[model samples]
Target: LKFVCLANDGIDEHMVWLIGLKNIFARQLPNMPKEYIVRLVMDRSHKSVMVIRRNQVVGGITYRPYVSQKFGEIAFCAITADEQVKGYGTRLMNHLKQHARDVDGLTHFLTYADNNAVGYFIKQDLVAVWRINGSVAMFRQQWMLRTFALRRNSQAESKNVS
Candidate 1:
């Protein structure tokens, strides 16, 4: 397995890249335009990590580093069904966090790793920091502190979205 950090790629090339991602995690991606992905890929404040096996993208994670906050954030992460339950997602996260810690100076994560994904996220050392009234979940974990929280994205449900 190899990892690629996507950045500054051309739009045409990004669109083609999105096609590969779409093939494995179809409909699992965030509800956003391809242009948004291109934007993320180009943004200097963000990072997108893709896990490739045999030249195909099997999993990926997008995150942003915070200059004012103490932790970074994971905006989204997904692994193809065929490649899941094989510790690949955890491996990707470990690599992602190592990059953030080594290159970005981030030590903790501020993310919402859905209810269905709580167990997995917990295993990755993400603590349940808060939950928005039992909707979506929130997480925060530091290598030092041991507090736990469950996040909730109430607005996500109100918006009638999954």
Candidate 2:
């Protein structure tokens, strides 16, 4: 699998990923707009990366640079249903973080995720910055410090032990 910068030619596959995410969100929220998926795809900034497997788009992460906050917000992240638990999501996220650091001049990343996704971000070393609605909603952030250091150290330790 390789990461690809989605172009107009890949919009159909991009819509598939978008629809999958929209369906998942609608099941939880119920009143989500039917056009929400398309809108997200259209509004995505240039920083988005699509994960492609055999020329098929399977996952993606969208980010927008914030000049005022001096950070980048990970607006949308989704992996296909058949592709979950295969490390694709993590790769997509890591790629996004690298892009933010190297290209966007961002040292911090923030996101608002649902309950099911909270643990995933937390496992990535993102800290809970705030919780809303009695902890049902969460806002999380990660800095380019302990998180990256720990990840690098863990990878090194694994290699050493091997």
Candidate 3:
């Protein structure tokens, strides 16, 4: 799978993929509109990325400024049914995480994912911070310091051994 960071230029394609995602969600959660899905994908305030396999979009994610006033929220993340379990989701997530730190200059990252994605986020080391009854769930900010420290320590250990 290939991942690309996109701007408004990709909104049309994104809306198509988002409609697919919305259909999947609608199976479990009723009353989700295509306009809401389109807004989630086309909204300018959010930064977005797309994952493609063989030139066909398979997954995408978006991040927007959070209500916290300090951290950015991962507004949306969706992988096509066929693309699930193939590591595309993980790749898209890592890409988003890195973008938050490097491009957005955000020290922390946040998200509100459903039960299906909660485990994936947890596996990525995102801590669950809050849950809004049956409707929404929130996760806390991801810190890059620990990752840098681990990489630095590994490099030092390698140099010492060499």
Winning model by lDDT: 1
Model 1 alpha-carbon miss at residue 65, Å: 1.1
Decide which is better by lDDT, 1 or 2: 1
Clashes of each: 14, 0, 0
How do all models score by TM-score?
A: 0.65, 0.63, 0.64
Each candidate: what lDDT?
A: 0.59, 0.54, 0.54
* Model 1 Cα RMSD, 1 decimal: 8.6
Candidates by TM-score, descending order: 1, 3, 2
User: In lDDT terms, how accurate is model 1?
Assistant: 0.59
- Per-residue lDDT of model 1, residues 18-107, tens digit only: 456544433455443455555554566666777887777787777777746656767667888777889988888778777877777766
Off by over 4 Å in 1: 9-19, 22-26, 29-44, 129-162
Model 2 Cα lDDT, one tens digit per residue, 1-162: 787544234467766654544454344433334465445545645345777767666767666677466676665667767777888878877777666666666666655554466556666655433322322222222211111221332321101000
Rank by lDDT, highest first: 1, 3, 2
Superposed on all Cα atoms, the candidates' RMSDs to the truth, in angstroms, are 8.6, 8.5, 9.7
- Kindly report which residue pairs in candidate 2 clash with one another: none
Candidate 3 per-residue lDDT, tens place, 6-83, comes to 545556775565454445444432334555655765676765677766666676776675434546766666776665
Give the total clashing residue pairs for model 3: 0
